[model samples]
Target: MPRSNWVSRVVGWDRPRREQPAWLHGDRQHLLPTHSHTDRHVVSTIPAAQVTKVALKLRHLVESAVPCDLDESEITRAHSSIITPEVVQAAKEAGGSEYRACVVFCLLICKAWFRQQSVVELWDADLHRGREVACEVIAKKLIETEDDTSFLLHNILLQRYSILVDGEPTYPANAIERAVDLHAVDVITSSGYQKCVDHLWRGWLVQDEDNPTTFVDYANRDKISFFTHLDPDRIRVPRYQNATQLLVTIAFLVLFTVAVNTPNPSGRLDVAEVLLYLFTLGFICNEVTKVYKAGYRILGFWNAVNGVLYTLITASFVLRMVGLGQPLDHGHEDPAHHREFYRTLSYNFLAFSAPLFWCRLLLYLDTFRFFGAMLVVLKVMMKESLIFFALLAVVIVGFLQAFIGLDIVDDMAVDEYGVIIKAMANAVMQSPEFDTFGRFSPPFGTLLYYFFTFIVMVILLNVLIALYNSAYEDIYQNADAEFLALFAHKTLQFVRAPDENVYIPPFNLVEIVLIALFGWWMPAGRFEQLNDAVMSCCYAPVMVAAAAYESNVARAIHRNRARGGSGDDYDDVVDHEWERVACAPETQVDFEAEGWDKVCEAAKSDIEVEPAVQEVRQLRAEVEELKRMLAEISRAVGAAAAGEESK
Candidate 1:
C-alpha cells in the first residue's frame, strides 16, 4: 500500500477512498535520478501511481518526523492552555509519533533563546493573545526559523528523506527546496553543478490554510471551583490549599514579634537598632517576593523600601564615624582617632556587608545574595529580635523608671553610663563554649556580665535553639515522606488500570499541620500532648526505612569491594559520612578511641564501626531511665503491699 493511501484511509476520504500502489525505490545514501522542472512537463506521460507514492511519502516525512506527545499532559492539565496555531501546526506537522523528540527540541530551543529579548516577546504574545494574532505573527517568525531553527529539523529529516541522483528526476520544485533545506546537498558533489541545483531550489512550503491554532482555550475560568467545577485537571492546586498556605504563612510571620523592641537611649536610633529595622523590612519584602505571579507588581514597593533602609543605615554609620573623627583614610588614623576608627569600621562592615551589592547596576547579583542572607537574618531575628529590641526599649524606658525612682546621671560621671552600656553589650554573645567554664576569662567577663550574657545568649539560646531546631528538623524530615507519597501514587498508577479522567494523586498540602497535631516534634511535646505513643508511631517507620536503605547500601559497597572493582567510583569520605548520617544509629556515635585496635581487625569496614557506639547514645538514655523508674516502682509497690498485709 502507498503511504498516501494510509492517511486517506485514516482520515476517511469523504467523497470516496482508493488504494494507491507504491514501492520503495531508494535508500537515504543511494541516489536515483528522477525528473527536472522540464521533465515534469511530461510527468503525466509517466506512471500516475509514482506521483501518488511520492506525495504520500512527503506527507509522512512532514507529519511523523517531529513528535510532540511529550507535553500532551501539560496541555491537558495546564491552567487553561493558551495554544497558538504555531504550537498547533508544529504539533500537527510533527504528529504524535515524534512527540518526545519535539519536546527535546523545544527544550533545546528554549535553553538557547531564554536570554534573548525576542523570545520573551514571542512568549508573552503567544501566552496571552488570541489565536488570530499568533497565526500571522508566527508565520513571519516561522520563515525566520530557516535561520534559527531547532536541531529537530535536521534530526527529523535525516531520519526520513533520501538523496536522489543518477537518472533525470521529476521532483516537485517545492520538494527540491525541502531537500535542500534539509541539507540534502550532499547528493550533489559533481563539479560546477551546484548551480544545476535548478528545479530543486524551492525556498517555501505553504501551510495548510485551515489549521488548528488554539487546540482548546479555557484561559478565563477560575482554577478550582467547589460548586460547578468543569475540570479538575485544569486546576494546579486543591480548592482549600490557598487557605491552608495563608494561615501557615501568617503563623510563621507572627513569630517575628520576637524581634520587636522599645527604643535606644537619648530617645535616638542607634546603628544596631537601625540595622535590625532594615532586616525586618527586608524580611517582609522576602515574604512578598514568595508570591510567584504578583511578586514584581505587589512587592516592588517593598523592595524599594528595603533598598532605602539599607542605604540609610549604611549612611548613618558613615556619618557617625565622621562625627567621631574616625579615619576616612590614613590622614585621620593617628593615635588620637585610631581605636575609634577601627571600631566604627568593624561595626559598619559587619552590619552592611550584604547591602553593598544593591546598586541597580548589579541588582540581579544583589538579589541572589539578598535572599540567602535574609533567610539567615530571619532565623536570627525570630528568636533574638524581641530580646534585642526589648533591651533597646529598656535603654529608653528603663532610664525613665530609674529616674522616677530618684536616680540621676547629672551628679554621677560619664564612666558610670559607659559601664551600663558596656554591661548590656557584653551580655549578647554567650554560647555553649561558656557552659564549660563556671567563670569568665580575661577576654570573657565578670559574674554579672556573664550571668546577663548567659541569660541572653546561653540559656535563652538552649531554650530557643531547642525549639527552632526541632521545628525545622520535623518539617525537613516530613518533606521526604511527602515525596514517598507521590512515589506511591505513581507506582499505584502502574499497578492498577485507571480512567484517564481520574486524578491518580491526591492533593499534597505539606503535612506539617497534621504532623504537628500528632505531637511528633523536636523537643517532642511542646505543641501537642506529651504522648510518646504518637511519637513512636511517627518516627518508627522512618527509622525502619532508613535502616533498610543503609543495609542495601552496605551490601552494594561490599559487593563492589569483593569484585576488585575501582573504589575510585565511590568517595570513601562521603561513603563514611553517609554511613554516619543514614545508618548511624539514633544512639550517639562514639568519638572515643578505645576500640581502634578491635575496629582495625574487622573484615568489613562497615562492621568495624561499633554498633554499641551508635545505639548507646539513644538506647542507653532510655534504658537507664527505664531502670530507674522500675526500681522506684518496685519500692513503692513493696511498701504499699507490705503495709496492707501488716494491717
Candidate 2:
C-alpha cells in the first residue's frame, strides 16, 4: 500500500484519495516508521483500588506533553500507529475504565512518532525533536511502567517530552474548517473532545506565564503539578478566591457607606482611615499583578473601568491624608473651614467611585452572557439614538427662534431655554398647552407647529425604534462569539494569580511594600513562608469563615439545580444545541404545505415561460414545411432529367 494511503487509513480521512505522481512519492516514503513500537506503557500489575487515580495521572502527563501547535491530523496518525494488537491486549487486561482508556489513548500518543523526513520541510525543528524523543523512550522501554505511583516520579525518559492534556480523545472531526480548521470554537464539546479545545480552555494553561510547569520534564515527574491551577505552593483554591473577593467587596461597601454618611463628611476625619488606605493599596497591587501577567493586554474595557475607580479611591485617600496633615490654626483664612473644604473634596472623590465599582460587577455576571450582550446592544442603540436626538435638537432650535420672533408668549412664562424645552415637549405631543401656538398671526405658526410635531413625533421616533431593532438583531446574531470572548477574559484573570506573599484585603498595606519594591528579589519559598506566617495568625479565622460561607452557597446552588429550579441550570455557560433550540422554539410550521406552495410558484413561472417556447416550436414547424417543398422540387427535377437521358 502507498504511504499516503497508509496515513489516510490510520487517521480515517474518508475523502477520496488522489493519485500521487512518482516525484511526490519520494517525499511521502519517509513518513512510514521503519520499526514497530512494542514497548507498551501499562499499569496492569498495580492495585485495582489505585488503578483509576494512577491512570488519570498518567493521562495528565501524556496530555501535558502535547505541544500547543501540534496538528490534530498529525497527533491522530501518531496515536493510530501505537495501537497495535499487543497494546490492545494489555489495555484489556487492565480493567477498561474510562480513566484507563484515556491513559492508554495518551500512551499511544506518546509512543507515536514521525519520520524526520516527514517534518524536514517545516521551520519548527524543536516540536519534531520533542516528539522524536518521546517515541525513542517508548521504543527503549526506559520509562518505568510497573509500579502505579512510583513510575510517575521515576520516569526520566518520559519526563522530558511527555504530552500533557485534558484526559479526553480529540478527533479530527471535532475541528470546524473555514480558511483553516478551528478546533477551539466547537459549539458542542463532547466530554472526550473538550480536552482538545485549546483556544477555549486548555490553551490558556500553556500560554500562562505564571504556570509552574513551564519546564516539561519537571511537570511530568511532579506529582503535585496541575495543568489549570497554580503550583501547589502558590495555589489559591477556588473557595479561597471566592472568600477574598467577597471580603474586598464588603470592605469597599462598608468604608464608602460610613464615609458618605458622616456629618460634614467631606471634612477631614480619622475614622476608618487605616482601612480605606489598606483597601486602596490592595487594589493597586492587584492591578499591577494583572499587568505583569498580561503585559500590554491589561487595557480592556473592564480593566479601564477598574482603573478609573482605583484612581478615585486613591485620590480620596491622599486628599484625606493631606487634610489631616494641615494645622487647625493656619495663617490663611479660617483654618478649620479650609480643612472642611479639603475633607469634603476627599469625600466627593470617594462618593464618585461607587458607581464605577458597581459597574465592575458586570464583568463577573458575564457568565449569564445574555445580560452582558444586552448591555452591549443597548450601548450601540444609545449611540445611534444620539444622531436622531441631534436632528430633533436642530428642529427644536428652529421652532424656538420662530416662537421668539413671533412674540407669541408672555416673557414671564417662557424664556429662550423655556421656549426650546416647551417646543421639544410639543414635538413629542407631551404638552397640552401647545394650543398656545395659536396666539401667533393667523395660518403660519399653527401650521408650522403641527407640521414640525408630525415629523419629529411620528417619523423620527419610528425611525429610531427601527434602528434599535436592527442593532438588537445584529448583536443577537453573534452573541455566542461575544460571550466566548467575555469568558476568555475571565479565564485570563485566574491565569495570572497574584503573588503568594500579598496580604489579604482589609490589611493588604504590607503588600504595597512587599510587592512594589522588593518583589523582584524575593524568593518564591521565602515569600510563601512570609504570607503563610502572617495570614495564619492575622486573618486565618476570617478566611476560614469565608470559605465555609462559600461552601454553603455552593451546596445551596447544587440543591437548587437538583430540584430543577429556574436559574440553576446555568452551571457552565457553554454553547449547546439545546440553548439554540430553547431560544427558538418550534412554532408548528406547516413545512409540507409550504413546500407545496413553493412548487406551485415554480410551476407558475414555468407556465409564464411556456408561451415563448411554444412560439419557437411553431416557427420550427414552418421551417420544416419549407424544407419539404424544396425536397419535392428536387424530385421533379430528377424526373425531368430521366426523360432527357431517355431521349
lDDT (tens digit, per residue) of candidate 2 on 347-383: 8898788787666655545556776687667657877
So what's the TM-score on candidate 1? Answer: 0.21
TM-score of each: 0.21, 0.40
Against the true structure, whose TM-score is highest? 2
Clashes in candidate 2: how many? 13
**lDDT (10s digit) by residue, model 1, range 1-647:** 11223223122231121121111121111111111112213222223333333333423332232222223333322221333344544633431443322222222122122213223466443332222222222222223233322222223211122122244332222222222222222212111112112101110111111211001112222122222222222111111122222333343233222222332222234654454444444443333323322223223433564456445545644544453554435465365465444444434543453343222223222123343233333444455446545654554355324422221333332224444444455444432233322222323333434455556675655666666665456434443333322222222212121111111111111122333343232342332232233333433433343334334444554555655543222232134565557554684555446785566667454442356665776788999999999999999999999999999
lDDT of each: 0.33, 0.46
Candidate 2 matches the true fold with a TM-score of 0.40
Highest lDDT model number: 2
